[model samples]
Target: MAATHDAFTTGKDDGDLRRRNIQTHEKANGGMVYKIEAEDTKKLQKKSNLVAFLDEWEFVIAPLIFTALAFFTRMWRIGLSPIVTWDEAHFGKFGSHYLKREFYFDVHPPLGKMLVGLSGYIAGYNGSFEFKSGERYPEELNYTSMRVFNAFFGAVCIPLAYFTARELNFKRPTVWLVTLMVLCENSYATISRFILLDSMLLCFTFTTTLCWARFHRLQKESFSPEWFFWLFLTGLSIGCVCSVKWVGLFCTALVGLYTVEDLWNKFGDLKMPKVELASHVAARVVGLIVVPMLVYMFSFYLHFLILENSGPGDAQMSSLFQANLRGTEVGKNSPLEVAYGSKATLKNMGYGGGLLHSHVQTYPEGSNQQQVTCYHHKDANNDWFFYPNRDHMDFNPETADVKLVANNDVIRLIHAQTGRNLHSHTVPAPVTKADNEVSCYGNTTIGDDKDHWTIEVVNDAVSSDYSKIRTLTTAFRLRHTVLGCYLRAGNVNLPQWGFKQIETTCVKENKPKDVYTHWNVEAHWNDKLPPGEAKNYKSPFLRDFIHLNVAMMTSNNALVPDPDKQDDLASQYWQWPILNVGLRMCSWDDNTVKYFLLGNPIVYWGSTASLGAIALLILWYLIRWQRGYEELSQHDIDFIHYSAIYPVVGWFLHYLPFVAMARVTYVHHYYPALYFAILSAGFVMDWTTQKLGRRVRWSVYILLYAAVIGLFVLFKDIVFGMQGSHQQWRYLKWFDSWRIVDQ
Candidate 1:
C-alpha cells in the first residue's frame, strides 16, 4: 500500500525511509518501456554524533559566553574616564552629606547615591571620609570612584535580566535575545555606570515587574504568605529607588497599582469575604506601603540629617581667601595663624549687614550709562589678587575693547584706554601695563560693521540711557541667538550681539519692571535706518549693540522665526532640548543592536503589521467556525487570544521611543517599552505559526520585517541623518554653523 511522508514505515529490508517514494515508468513509441527507480537516500540517513552533541550544547554555552562578553563590555573602561558629569556632582555631594550627618534639603532622595557611594567605598576610596571640613578635592577623581561603583551594579543587571526572563520561562534563544539587548543598548550602557541613579532605578523596576508577573501566574492559590512577601519586597526595592531620585516615583506609582491587583486577585473568591478582604488589604498596607515608605523616608532623612560642614572661608579654601584677608591688618592677624583658623571667624566673613545698615548705590538721573558694581578688586599687599571686600566696583560706561580674565587666585582686567591697551592686575598689588596699540573692541555697531558680526553676547546689562552694553557685571545674564550673525539689532552701525529677547517682569522695591530683548531681525536694514546714517558709525560698542538689536527685527527673510508667528515653537524649551533634539547626544557605538532591533523605527512599523495580522486572524477564525470546521481546543483558543494581544502590546512598546526620543530627556526610559515590545513579538510569532500553519507564515513575517526595515532606512537619512552633520541642522541653541567650541 502507498504511504504519505509522515506515515511511511521502514523495516530491515528497506534501505532507507526516503527511498520508499513512489516511482513512475515512461515508454517510447516502441513496445519496450523503462521503469524509473527511487533515488538513494544515503546522505539523508547519515547523522553525526559529534555534530548532534555540538548542536545540543550550542544553546546552553553560547549565551553563557555572550553574557560574559556583555559583562566585560560594561566593565571595559569602568573608571577610565572619570570626569564628573553634571548630575553626578549633585548626587555625590548629597551622598557625602548623608554619610556625614543627615537631613539634607536636596530635590532627590539619597539611596541611589548611597548605593553609588558604596562602590567608591569598595574601590578603596571614601570621598565622604577623605576630604576634611572646608576642603575641596579634584571632582574628577571622586566621580571616577563613584562611577566604578555604579558600573558594577550596571554589569550585574545582566543576570537580573536573565532571572526576569526565567520567570516567563523564556526559551534559551529568547533569553539570549534579551541579554544581548540589555548588554548592547547605548542609553542603557551609558546610564548604567553613570553616577546618577538610573541603573539602580531600572534594576528595581525590572525586579518589581518580575515579582508582579510571578504573583499573577500563581493566581489560583489563596493569598499565600510568599506572595505577600514578594509584594512587600517589590515595594521595598522601588521605595529605595524612589528615595534616590524623585523621578522614580513614577515607577513607584505603577508598583502601587500592581500591589492592589495582587491583593484582589489572591483573595477575591473567599467565602469568608469582607473581614478577610479587609485583613489582607490591611496586611498589604503595613507590609508593602508602610514599610517601603519608611525605607524611602529613611533615605531622605538620612540625607537631611547631615549638616553642611564646608563654608566659603573653610581652611581648605582659606588659602584662596588668605591673601585678600592679609592685605587688611586685624588685631588677630598672625604669621603663625592658619588662613582661616576658627569656624566662627570664617562664618563671620559671609555675614551681610542688616538691611537697615545696608548702603544703596543709585545710577545718575541724567546719565545714559548703566551703573553696575565691578566685582573685580585690587589688593595692595597682593598685586595680582582679587580683593574680596573692595571687589564691589561699578561699571560706569559702555566701553569697547574690554578684556576680563578671572582665575581662582586673581582677576586681570585689560582694556584700551587713551588708544593704548592697559592691564590692571588685581589681588596682592595693582599694576597697569600697556601691551598693545589697536583695541580689540571696535566702535562699530554690530550689524553696521558688516564684516564684524557680534556672533553672540555672553552677558549684557541695560544702560541708564536705554542702550544695551555687554559686560561681565551683569547677573541673570541674557544669552544671544545667532543665525550666521548679522545679529538682530536696530542699526548695523551700532555695536550689537545676538540676545534672545525674553520678557522678564521683575519686582524690586515693590515696583514691577517689564524687560524685553531682541528676538528677530528685519528684512530690509536700509529701510529701518535714517538716510545717510548707515556709513558714519565709528564706535564698536554702538555697532555691537545695534547688531544684537537687529536680531529682533520681524521679517520673513531672517533665519529666526518671527515673534508673531512663533505660536508653536519648532525648537525645544530653552532650558531643555534633549527630548526635542535627536538621540545623537547620548548615543554610543556599543548598543547599536538595542537602538536598532527593538522599539526602533522598524519595530514601530511592525506594530502596524501586527495589528493587521490580528484582524486577519479574527476573520479566519470566524469563517472557520461558520463553516462548522473542527472546534479549537482550549489550548488553541488561549494561544490565539494571547496572540491577539501582541499587536496592542507591541503598539504600547513603541510609545517609549516617543517618550524618550520626544517627550523625555532620560535614556533609560526606553527599557520598559523595549521589554514589552520584544515580549509581544515573540508571542505573536509563536502563536501565529502554531495556529496558521508554519509552512508559509515565516515568509509573511520576513516580508513584513523587510518592508519596515526599508522604510526606516529611507527615513533615517531624511530625518535623523548622520551625527556629524548635526551642525547643519542646528537642533540646539549652541549648535551654530560657525561655532568654535567643541560640541
Candidate 2:
C-alpha cells in the first residue's frame, strides 16, 4: 500500500514542471515579435526624414548632382591616353622638374607647375618619368592621379557657374542653364581632362569671379565678416589666376572695375560719411592690391625655395643670380671684377637677346666674314677676350698687377678661338637690311679702323676718371668712332641657314631711347681674384621676379606665329566666337584612343545668338529710355540692366583683349570668355522670361536643355577621349577647317 502512494506523488510533480516550461517559451517568442516591430518603426522614420530633407533642398541638391555628373564625365578615362597631350608635355616635365628640385625656365609663373608637382607627389609619383611628348607613361608613374586632380578642379566650374548665376539673381532655370552650359561644353571638358595648366587657370578664374560677385552683392553691408571673407578670397584667387597665366589679368581687371564702380556708387551715397569711404578704399587696397602682391611674391619665393639645384634655366639668369644657385659653375661670393685679357661673355641689356657671339659660319650672302650673332645660350662660341685696343694683347697675370677695365676706354674684343677682332662696317645686316652688318675680321695682331669701338659708359656724364667704371655693374655703349654707329642687338632672327640666332647689327641712329645698344659684362673669368668658399646663397626674389617677367614678355612677343603660315588648327579671335575652327587634342586610329577639342554646336551657336540678342536688347532699351517711353522696376533694372551688363563687360574684357594679342591663340584661349558669354546669355533669358507666361517659359527652357543634352551626346566620345572611327569623325566635322584626320 505504501509503494502505490509514492508513485502517484511523483507523477503529479512532473506534470507541473512541464506546464511552467511551456508558458516561459510562449512569452519569449512574443517579446521577440515586439522588438522587431519597434526596429521597423525606427527605420521607417529615418527614411522619411531623409526624403523630407532632400525635398527641402531640392534646388541645391540638383546642382550638386549635376556637379557630380560633370566630375564623373571629366574624370572618366582621363588616363586613357597614357601619354602627354599638347602642353602636358611641357607642363608635366616642369612638374617633374619641381619634384626633383631641378630648376627650369617657363613662360608662365611656377605656381601651376608647383601644383602639378604637389598633385603627383600626393599620388605617389616618384618623379622618374621624362614626360616627353607622345612618349607613353612608364608603368611605375602615377600619371592618372595628376590627370584626375586637374579634372577635379575642372569639374568645380560647373557648380561655380550655377552659384555665380544665382548670385546675379537669375531664375532657377537660368542657373541650371549656366551650369549645363559649362558642363556640356566640349572644349572645357577636353582641356580639363588633361594634365595642362588651362584647367587650373579656368578653375582659379571662376573662383575669383564668383568670389568677386559675392563680394559685390554684399557691398551694402560694409565691414561684414562675410563680405571681408569673400573680398579676401577674391584677392587670393586673383593671385592664383595671375600665377597661372597672364590671361587672368582680364579677370583681375573685371574685379577691379567692379570695385571701382562699387566705390563710386558708395561715393554717391551721400548718407555715408567720408571717413567710411576712406575706410572702404583702404580695405580694397589691402585686399585687392596688397594681398595679391603678397601672394604673388610668396608664390615666387616658394618657387625659388623648391628649385635649389642649378638646372637648364641657369643660363637665362644673371651671373650673380646663377652664382647663388647650387651646382652652378659660378661660385658664390666670387669676385666679379673684370680685367683686360680675361675671357668673358657680354649679354645685351635688351630682354632675351643672347650673348655676344661669333662662330666660324660666315655670312653666306653678304660681307663673307665670320658671323657675329646674338645666341641666347651659353656656348664656347660666345667667349671673347678683352684687349687694350689691340687685335692680340694678353695681360700677363704673374708679371703685372691686376688692372680693372674702366669706363671711356678704347677696347678691342677678340673671338677667343678664331682670334678675329670684332668688326662692324657699312654692309647691311642679313635680316634688318637697314642696319650695318657686324662680324669678326682682321686675325693679325693689328686691326683696321673698322674694329675700333669707344666704350661710352651709359649715364656716366662723360667722366674722365677711368677708375669709376665697373665691369658687371656699369652699362656701356659700344660706339664705332669712324662709322658713327652704335652696336645693337636687334630683335631679329637670322635665317635657318645662319643657325636661327639673333642678328647683331650696327645702327647709325644715336637715339638715346634705343635700349638695344646697351650691353653689360655678364660672366667674367679671371685668375686674379681669389675663389670664395661655397656657402648658403639667396637671390633677391623681387628683382628676379621682375627680370623673369621682362624675359617672358620679350620671349612671348617673339613667339607669335605668322598668320600667313598655314596651320589647319589655328583660328583668329574673330573666328573663335563663330566656331569657325576646332583644335585637335589627340588623333589616333580606330584601334586606339582619340580626342578632338570641339565645342557643342547647339550650346555655342545658341549662346552666340543670345549674345547678339542681348546687344539688340541693350540698344532698344537705350533708345526707349532716351525717348522717355519705357519704365522698369528696380528688380528688372538690377537683374536685367546692371547685373546683365557685368557679364557683357566681362566678356569684352576677356575676349576683346585677345584681339590685340599677337600670340598663337587657339579655340581653348576663348574658353574664359566663353564662360562669360554663357552667363550673359543666361542673364538675358532671365530678363526676357520675366514678362512671359509660365508655360511658354518652361517650354523654352525644356527645349534649350534638350538641345544642350543632345549636343553633349553627339560629342561625348571626342570630349571623353573615346575610340572612334575616321568616318564617324568625318561626319562630326561640321566645318571644312576642322581637320579630324586619323593618326
Candidate 3:
C-alpha cells in the first residue's frame, strides 16, 4: 500500500503545482519501501524552489548568469559623463528628429535612429535637447534611462553568443569562454553605455549570427515548421541588421554564402526526389530572399509614413517627393509649365545629381568666370530666369508674346542671384578635361552668342510623349548653339577652391542620350501659368526608397579622407586588429570623466591570432585531403564546418571588405568583425584543448582565464570611468601609437 500527503511550503510554488511527498511507499510487486522523515521533507522543501532552474542548467541557468554579468557591466556608472559624447551628439540629434516626426536624411537607414527615439520616448525625455558634443545635459532629461535602454541591447549580445555556441554544438568550456569574451569586451560595453546606434547594430548583428547558426543546424529537418520558423527568424534578423547600418550587410553576406553552399550540396544529393529539391529551393527563396526584402521595405515604409513634414533633408530627395512634404511650398502655387521669363531651378537627372547653380565666386582654374556648379542645397543661387534668345523674340513684359517653352526652343538662362548668364566655352574643363568649361558670364543685359542655348525636350521614358515642357516631369538637354556641346553635370567634384560642388560642364562628344546632360525644372515660379494638380504628382514608395538609397550611397562614398584635414581620431584598417590605436569617446578634459575605446589586449590579440591559425590549419588540412589522406574523422569534418569554417567565413566577410573601402574608417567599424573573430578563437581554443593531455588542457584553460580577466581589470577604467591626468593610466600605454597618453 502507498500513501501521500501535501508538504508545508515556505513560499508559493511558481511551477506547475505544489510538491507531494509519500509518507509510505510500495513497489509494483506490493513490497514496502522506506519512508521519508519530516527532517528530510523540510530540507527538500527548502531546495524545491531551485528545482525548475537546476534541471535546465545549460539552457537556462548559464544564460541567466551571463546576462546578469553583461547588464551589470554595461549599466555600471553608464551615465557618469552627464554630457554628450562623440557620435552621441549626431545620433541623439537624429533621435530628436524622429521624436519631432520631421523628415531628415542620413547616409544610414532609419531603423537605428527610430529605436533611439523610441527609447527617449520611453524614458520620458521631452526631446528638447539638441545633444551637442561636450555640452552638459539638462537635469530634466532622463539620460540614464536612455543609456540603459541601449545597454540592454549590448547586454543581450552575451546570451546570444552563448546560445549561438550551443546551437553550433560547442562543448561546455568553449561555450562559456565565448560568452565570457563578449561579456568582458570593454569596447562593446563602452560603446553601448551611450545613446548611439552602434550597440543596437551590434545586437542585431549578433542576433543574425545566432539565428543563422540555429537555421544551419536544422538542415536535416528540411521543410518542417521548426525549420521554417528558424529560417524566417534568420531572415528577420538580416532585415534588422541591415536596417541599422550598411555594415549589417556583412552579416547578411555570411548567411548568404552559407545558404548558397547548402543549396549546392543539396543539388548533388541524387537520392533526393525532384519535387523535394524544387520545394527546398522554393522554400529558401521565400524564407531568405523574399522575406528579407519585404522586411527591409517595410522599415522604409514606416520611415516614409512618419516623416511627412519637410525639414533640412528635403532637398536630398527627388523634387516630386519633396513637393509632397507637409510644409513644402514648391508646388503649392507654382506653375505647371515652362515659359519665357519663368524663374526656375533646374535639377540634373543623373544619379546623385544636384541643382544647377551659380554663385558670386569664380573658378580659379577653369574659365576664370563666375562658378556655375551643381549644388545639393536649395537656395536663391539655384534659381534662374528662362529668357528667350535676343535673336528669337523679346521677353519684355510689354512686348513678349508669352510663348510657352517647347521642344527645341532657343533660350538664355540668366542666374537670378548674380544676374549672370549661363555660358559655355571651348576652354578645357577643370575636372573633366574632355568636356567644355561651363561658367557664368556677363549680366542680364550684357552677353554674347555663347549665352544662347537650345532646349530639346527629352521624350518621356514611359509614354514617349515630348510635345510640351512641364515642371518636375519633362527632362530637357541644353545644347550650346555655336559649340553644339550639351550641358552636363556629373558626380565629379571640383577642386577645393570650387567649394567641392558637383562639376558642371558641356559634354563635347554630343551624346544626346547621356543622363548627365538631362535636366528638369524642379522649382518653377510663373504668375502667368496656373498651378499644377497635386493629384497628378504621386511619389511611389518603391521609387522613393530606391532613389534615397542610391543617394545615400553616393553621399557615403563622398566621405573619403581629405588630405588637407588631418583627423587624429581616424585610424586605418591595419591598426584595428593589432591594437595599434584607441579612440577618444569624448572631449578629453578634467571637467568630465574620460572614456576610451580600447579592448582588452589579451582578448584582442588572442582572437586575431586564433583567426590566423584557423586560416593556416585549413590550408594544410585541404592539401592533405587532396593528397588522398584520411586523417580526419566524420566528427572532425562536422566540427570544421559548424565551428571553424562558419566563423572564419563570417570574420572575412566582415573584415576584408574594409580593406577595399574608401570611406573614413573607425575603430568601432571593426566591432562586428571582432565578434566573428572571437568565435573563431573559441573554435581554436576548443580544438587545441581537445588534442592536449589532461594536465596541459587544464593549464591552458587556467592561463587563458587569468590573462583575459587580468587585462580586463587593468583596462576596466577605460570603459567604466577614468578621471584625472593621462599620467595616472600610463601603465596601459602599451602601444605608443594608441592615444592613451597625451604629449
Candidate 4:
C-alpha cells in the first residue's frame, strides 16, 4: 500500500520506483507514510524557486515598462502648440511674478505657483514675458522645459497610482489597467503639457494615498521605522496638496477619516493595550495634524520671503500690510496717526471685504443715493474724509492741539469727490435684502442723523484716548446711532450699476463673533504732519498667514456667478461625471493649433459606467450578507471592503463636494474623481475575470485595451495640437455640448 501511494505521488515511472523513498510503518495504526527521494525534493524546490523568481520579475518589470510608456506618451509633442492654454496663462504669469519677486494675488494658495516658478527659473525663464492666453511663446524662450517640468510630475502620477493599487493589494492586471487609463486619458495628457497646477495636485494626492496605504500595511510591525516614515510622508504630501488649492482639504479630510477608523480598529484589537492605543493616537496626531500644519505655514513663509515687493496684489491686502512691502507708496515705518477731516481709505476688518468706496453711480432701485460699496481695488473712488459729526469740523493740527477722534466719538464719513456723507437708511440692501442699504446721502458740511455713527474701539476701553486709535493697526466698529445697527460689508455684490462691488449693509443683530462690522482706518492723508519715518519693517508671519487664509476663504465664498449672466463653459456637478460640457482652451481663425479641453468620450463614459457597477455590486454584497444566503471567502471579503471600497471613498470625497459648490465648475474639476473611478474599474474587472474562463478573461482585457488605445488615437489631434480639419473635428465630436467648432 505504501509502494502504491509512493508510485502514484511520484508519477508512474521505473526511475521513480528505483529512487530511494523513506517509509514509516505505524505500529498501532494500519497506515504507512512515504516521503520523496532527496533528488526529487531538490527538483521540486528548484521548480518552486523558479516560479517565485518569475513572479517577482513580473511585478517589477511589468510596472516599470508601463511607467516608461506613460512617461513617453505624456512628454511626446508636449510643446508643439507653443501657446498658453487655459489656466497655463494664469499660472505661468504667476511663476514669472515669483521669478521677478513681484507680489500677485490668486484665488489658489501659493505653493503650486512657487513650484512652477522654481521649475521655470531653473529652465532659464527670465520672468519678462506676459503669459496671456492664446499668445505665442517667444522663439528664444525655453517653454518646453517648463512644460516638461509639469509633464514630469504628471508622469509620476501613473507610477504612484500603480504603487497605490499594489499597496491596496490589487492584482498585477488591475494595477496595469489603472496605469493605462491614466496614461491614455486625453484631459490629463493635455493639462500636463501646460503650466497648470492640476498635475502637481494629482501627484501629491496620489503620493499621499499611497503612503497612507503603506502605513496601514506596516501596522502589524507596530511602531517600526518604516511605518513612521510612511506615516510622516503621508502628512507631508497632504501639506503639498493643501498648499496647491483649497480643494485639497477634501483629501486631508479623507486621511483624517481613515486615521480615526484605524485608531478605532486598534482599540478593538484584544492584543493591543490601552497604553499602546494611546501611543498610536498621539503619533497620528503629531504626524497628521501637527506636521501638515507646520508644512503649510512654511510654504507661506517662503511665499512672503520671496514676494517682498508689492505689485498687483497690494490692493487685496490691508493698507498697513502693503506699506510694509517694498516699492509701495507708503514707507515701512509710517506713523499711526489719524486727524479729523483727513482723506482716508477705510478697510473692513472682515476677512476679505474691500476698501470703503463711493462712486457716481447710485443704487438702481433701492435708496437711489450714490452707491456706497466695498471695492476690492485701490482707486480714487475709495477716498473719503473723516469729519466730526454734523459740524464737519476739521482739526487744526498746526495751531490748535492735535486731537484724534477718540473712542465713542460720533463721526461722519463724507465722499471726497461727490461731497455726500456715508449714510445708511431703513431701505433693504439690494443683494442681502434683509439688511438696511448703505448709501451716500447729505451734501458736504450738512448731514442727517442717518449719517451719524458712534465709534466703538474693538478690544479697548471706552475711556481710551483718541491718540491710542492707531491708524491701520487698531480695529473699530461703526454703529449707526439712528438705526441702532452695525455698519458692515456682507459679501453680497451689487449689480452692474454699482460697478459690481460688494454691498455695504447695516445689520441689526450684533453677533459677538460677526467680524464683518469691524473696520480699520487704512490710509490717512494729512499735510500738517511731517513724512513718517521709514524703517525696515517685517510683517508678523503668523498673523499674515492667518489673515491670508481667512481672506482666501472669504474670497472663495464670493466667487459665485451672477444669476443674470451666463457662462458657456460652466457645468453642473452632475454634468461633469457625464462629460456634458468641454472648456475651450485656445482657438485661432484658421484652426491651426486649436486646443479644446475635453476628455476621451470612451474613457469618461466607461469610467462612469464602471462606477455605477461598483456601487451596485457593493449594494448586492450588503444585501446578500444580510440575507445569509451567500457567503464570501475571507480574502474576497477583505478585498471588497478594503481594496475596492477605499478608492470609491476617495472618489466620493473628491467628487461629491463639488455638488455643494455654487461657483462655476469645469470638466477638469472632475479629473481627480475620475482617477478613483478608473481604479474601481480595474478592481471590478480583475474580480470579474477571476470568475471567467482564462480565454474569455484575456479576450475581455484585450478588447478593452484596444478600445482605449483606439479612442486615444482618434482624439490625439485635438489634445496634442496636430491641427485637424473642420471635417475631421466634426467626425470626432461625439456630443453637441462639446462645442468643437472651428474658429
Candidate 5:
C-alpha cells in the first residue's frame, strides 16, 4: 500500500512537469514567452547600446585630449619669444609699405601681403603715403604686433588640421599623431610665430585640400549636397591660396588630375562601350576639370570685382592694374621676328638671334686663350637634336691674340662672340651713347676706348646715360639680357671691403690646386647662359674632390677645414644642398640667428627621404600590381591622396618667392626642396598607418606608428640638431620644449 502511494505521487509530479512544458511551448508559439524575453532583450539592447557608446567614447576621448594638448602646444609661449625672423622682417617692412601707399616689388603674389595689411589696418595702420623717412607707423605697430597676428593664424591651423584629418577618416590615433606633429613641427611652428605668409598659405592650402577630400568622400552618399558645399569651399580655399601665391594653380591642377584619374578608374571597371566611355570621359571633364577651374576663376573674379569697386582700401585685388602698370604686357612681334630675328639690315654683325642664339665666349685680346664655345645650335624650323663634340682648339697662350684652332685640346670653340658669361670671364659690348635708347642695357657702363671700343665698369648712374644713347642701339642683344638674370648692385659692392674675394678652393688628388674665385659664385654674378653642354659642366677635378669630401662626411670624418665650425653638416657630409647661410636662407642677413635656418643639410636630406617614402606609397597605390595589396578604404585613400599630392605639389607652387630669389641668388630655392622632404614624412606616416591597419589590429598599428614617429623625432634631434643647443634643437624641431618636460 506504501509503494503504490509513492508511485501515484511520482506519476502526479511527472504529469505536472509535462503540463508546465506544454504550456511554455504553446506560449512561445503564441509569442507570449517571446514578449517576456523581448522585455529582457530590450534591456539587453539598451545595455549593448550603452557598451557601444562607451567604446566610441573611449576611442574618441583620447583624441580629444590630444587635440587639447596640441592646442596648448601651439598657444604656449606664443608670444614669449616673439623675435622677428628674416621673413618676418621682410613681411613687416611690406606691411609698413602698405600703410604708406608705397608699392614694394611683387616677388610674392599680392594675397599674403593683403592679409598682413588687413592685420596692420586693424592696428590703426592705414594705407597712408604720409611718412617721408620710411617709418610708416608708431612704436605700437611693431614686429611684436605682427607676431601676435601670426599667432592667431597659427591657432586657426590646428582646427583646420583636425578637420582635414577627420575628412580623411583618419583613425583617432592617426589624427592625434598628425595634429601633434603639425603643432610641434619646427617649420610650421617657426613660420606661425612670425608675420610671414608661409604659415597662412599652408593653412589655406590644407583647408582647401580638406574640403576637397570631404567632398570626394561624400559624393557616393544618398543626400550628397555636402559634396557640392565642400567643393565650393574647396574652390574658395584654392582662390585664397592663389591670391596669396600663384602656386595655388597647381593645387587645382592636382585636383582636376585626381578627379579625371578616379573617373577613368571607376568607369573603366564598369566595362562601358567605347562611345559611352568617351561620353563618360567628357562628363567627367565637365564635372572635375571644367567645373573646378570655373570655381577657381570665379573666386578670383570675386576678388577682382571687389577690388574694382572698393577703390584703394580694398585688399582683394586681381593686380590686373598693378600688373599692367608694372608692365607684364609684351608687345606683339611679327611671327618671323619672334621665331628668328629679322636680318633685313644685317651687316658684318650678323649672328643667330632670337631664343636660339649660341652664346660663346670671344677670346680676350693678347693671350692665346682657348675660347669656350657653347654648342646651342637650335634651328628655328627643325627641332633640336644630339651632336658629338669635336676636340678643343689649342690656343697659343704666349701670343697676345689667342688664335684657337680645333682638334688639339679637349675644349672646342663653336662660335665667336655669342654671349656674356660672368663666371666664364667674358663680357659683352657695353651700351654706348649711340645704343643708350634700349632699356636692355639700361644699367650697363659704356666707354669708347680710343681705337678699341671697350665697355667700362661704371656706376649705374653712368650706365643710364649710356642706355639713353639712341645711335648705338644694338639689335642683336643676347637673350640673357631679356631672360637671364644679373647680379645685384649690393652684392657687387661688398659691404666688408676686406672680404672681397671669397674663394672656394678645390683640393684635387689631396692637393689644393684649382680654385673657384668666388666661394659664393651665385652672390657675385647672375648665372644666365643659354642651354648648352656647359650646363652640366662641373669641373671633373672638383667633382672628384667633392665626392671624396662627401664620402668622408658620410663616414663621420671632418671634411671642412674649419675646426671652430666642426659642428657644420658640411664638415661631416658633402651633400648637394649645403647646410649654411650661403645656400638655404640667402635673403636673410648671415650674421643673424635666422641664418642658421638656411643651408641646413640634415633637414634637407631628411625631407628628401620623406619625399621618397611618399612617392613609394603613391606609386604603390597608383599601380594595379601594388594597389590590391596596399588597398585603403575609400575614405583613407582620399586622405592619402590629398596629403600626398597637395603638399608635395604645393611645396613647388608656393615656393615662388624662393624661386624668384633664385634668379637673384641661389639660397631661396632650399625651402621648396627641403619642405618637399619634410612634408613627405607626414605622408609616409599616414601611408604606414593605412598599411599597418589593413594587416594587423588598429591599436597595434597605432602603437607601431607612434614608435616610428618617436624614432623619427629621435633622428631629427640627434642628426639634424648636432651642433644646436638643446633648447634651440627642441624649439626648432618640436615647437614645444614642455613636451620634453612632460616626457
Candidate 6:
C-alpha cells in the first residue's frame, strides 16, 4: 500500500509527520530502481479525511455561503424601482457629468462618482437623462447593469467581514455570525442596490478595516512580503475610502490610532535596534501616509483630466480653474487690467467666498433696499461695472480713456443686471447683525458717498506694486468711503426670504490680513482694452486641489437643515442607533415599486444593544483588573482588544463625528457605524454562547438564526423593492414618523 507525503496526520507539521515508508531496491532494465512502501495506509487515509473535513467546515464553506447570500440579496431585482431615488438624483447626475466629460462639483471626493460613471458607461448609457428624483429611467438605459455593478461592492462586503473577523482571531462560529449579520443587513443591501455613492463608500470602508486587521495580524512576520502587501493594501484602501467620501476618514483614523499604538509598543523594546525603529517609521510613512495621499491625489488628477469641458458646476470652483476648462468663458477675457468702466465679477478672496451679486428683490426686513448678496453660481447678477465714484467726474465706458483703476481708486460698483449701486449703511446686516448692512440702494444715475468705495490694494506675494489692478492675481479691499468699514463676505447665510445666499456685510474692523475683506477681479470684460493671454490665467494643481477641498467643506457645512422647513427625512445621530426613523427612497404612489431605508429589527436592535454590552463588559473587566483579580486569560485579553475593542473604536469614530457635524444627515449615514456594530453583536452572541453548555449553545444558535432570518424576510421588501400600496406596509410600521406608508 502507498501513502501520501502528509501521511494524513492532523496538527503535525510536514517535517514531523513521518512517511513510515520502507525503501527497497529492485533490478529493472539493467539499472537499480528504488520503491517506497507505506506501513500505515489506513491511518493516513483517516487523517487525510479529517483534514479535508476541517478545511470544508471550518475554513471554506461559511464564507462561500455568506457571499452567495449577500450577492443574491443585493443584486436580485435591483432595478425593480426603475426610478431615481433619494441622493441618486444628485450622485447619478454627477456620474452623467463624467460620462459627458463635463466639469461638476460635489461635497464628496471624485472616486465613487467616477466608479458610478464607469458603470453607466459600461452599461452603454448616453448620459442624457436628467436623473430627476422619482423620474423613471429610460427603457434602453440598462440601469440594471449599473445597479448590479454597484451592488457587487455591497455583496462582496460579506466575505470581507468574514475575513476581517478571522484576522481578528475570532472563533469560527463567531466569524460566521458576523458574516451572516452583514449578509442579511437589509439597509446595507437596500442602500447599495442603487446608483449611489454609499455602496462604494461602504465597500472601501470594509476593505480598509479588513486590510488593517490583516496587517496587524502579520506583525510577528514584520517586513515580510506578505506584511508589506497587506500594509500597502491598507493604504490603498484608505485612499479609496476617503476618495469616496470624507466620512471614510473616521475609519482611517481608527487605523491610524492602531498604527500609533503598534509603533509605541515597539518603541518600548530596548532590544530593538534604532535603525529597525527608523525602518518601521519609514515603512508606516510610506505605506500609510504617502501611498494613500498619492492614491487620493491621483483620483483628483483623473477627475481633472476627464472633466475638461465646462459645465454647470463651473462656478463652484475658482475662476482660474474654470478658465482651464475647455468651454468656460470665465477668464477668456477681452482685458486683463481692472480699468475704469470695466465690467467684471468680483470674487471674494475669503475661504468659501463667492461672486459679488445683487437682485431687484428687496430684503423683507432691515433697510428694505435691493438685496446685495454673495452668490456661488454664475449669472448676469454676479456682474458689476466699475464706475468713477459718485463724487468724481462722470465716465462713460464707450468713450472713456484707458484709465487703469489702481490703488486708492474710488469706484462705485453698479450691478449689471439690476442697475443698482452697491451701497452700505450703519443698519445691522441681515445675518451678521454685528456688521453694517450692505445693500443696493442707488442706481447708476442716483447714489451718495456711501456708494463710493476706496479700493485699498493689498500687496501681492510676487509684486509690491498695487499700481496696476490686475485680473486674478491682484487682491484688494473695498473700504466703505463713508462708514470707513470694509466690504466683506464671511460665509454667513441670510434667511430663507433672502434666497439663502451669502450675506454681504461691511465690517467695522479694518484688518488688512482678514481674508473676508479681500476681493479680486475674477472675470474681466473691457472691449476697449487688448485681450490677455490664456497662459497668464493658468493655476497650479496644488492650489486648485486645496481650493476645491476647502470649497467642498464649505458647501458641506452650508447644508444645515432649515428650521422653518419641514424636513421629514433628516435624522439625528441619537436616532440612528435606535433606528427611530426611516427615509422614503421614492414617491409614495400606490402602484409604484418603492424602496425605504430601514434596518432589520433583529439585526439593528441587537447591534445597538451589543454596544452597551461591550461597554459594560469593559467596565466589569477594568474593575476586576483594578482589584488585582485575573478575570481573563491572555487569549481572552487579545480577543477583547482585537475583536471587541477594535470594532467599538471604529463604531465610535464613525458615529460620534456625526453628532458634531452641522450638515444635514440622513438614515443612510448610520450604516458605516452599523457595520462595526454588527461585528460587536456577533462578539456578544459568541461571548454568551462560550459561557453556556453545548446544549444551551445550540439552542442560542438556533434561536438567533431564526430571529435574524425572520426579521430579514420581514424587511426584505425594502431591498427587493416594495410594490402595491403604502397601506400594505402599515403592519411593518413601528413609528408613525417612519412614514413607511400613508398609514
Q: Is 1 or 4 the stronger prediction by lDDT? A: 4
**Cα lDDT computed for each candidate against the true fold:** 0.37, 0.77, 0.83, 0.77, 0.39, 0.84
Tell how far residue 704 is off in model 4, in angstroms.
Answer: 2.2
Worst 10 residues of 2 by lDDT: 1-10
Worst 10 residues of 4 by lDDT: 1-10
How well does model 3 score by local distance difference test?
A: 0.83
Cα-lDDT of candidate 6: 0.84
What ranges in model 3 sit over 4 Å off?
1-55, 392-394, 397-401, 459-465, 509-514, 533-536, 626-628, 693-696
lDDT of 1 by residue, 464-549 (tens): 32122111111111121111211111111111111221101111111111112121110011112222211121213333223222
lDDT of 6 by residue, 1-743 (tens): 01111211122333224452222222222233222223244566676777667755645676787888898999988877778888889988999999999998888999999999999999999899999988888998998998899999999898899888777665556676778788887899899899898988899999999999888878888999989999999999999999999999999999999999999999999999999999999999999999999999999989999999999887777666776888778778547777888899998877667899998899888899999989988888899998998666566788878888889988888999888899999899987889999999778787778898999989553356878787777789999988999999987888888899988999998799998899888888988889886435567788778878888888888899889888878888898898888888878887688888888878888999999999999999999899999979987887788889989999999999899988888988989999999989977876766756656676777788777778889878877988887788788888877778784
The number of the candidate with the highest TM-score is 6
Q: Please state the error at residue 537 of candidate 4 in Å.
A: 6.4
TM-score (all chains, Cα) for each model: 0.45, 0.85, 0.90, 0.90, 0.47, 0.91
Off by over 4 Å in 2: 1-56, 331-335, 363-368, 391-404, 426-436, 456-477, 481-486, 490-500, 507-518, 526-538, 562-566, 741-743
Model 4, 481-520: lDDT tens digits are 8998998986677777776778899988986457788887
How many residue pairs collide in each prediction?
72, 0, 0, 0, 21, 0
- Tens digit per residue, CA lDDT, model 5, 185-242: 4444444555678666766767766676666666554125554566567666766766
The residue-level lDDT of candidate 5 at 103 comes to 34
Weakest ten-residue segment in model 3 by summed lDDT: 1-10
Where is model 6 poorest over a 10-residue stretch in terms of lDDT? 1-10
Number of backbone clashes in candidate 6: 0
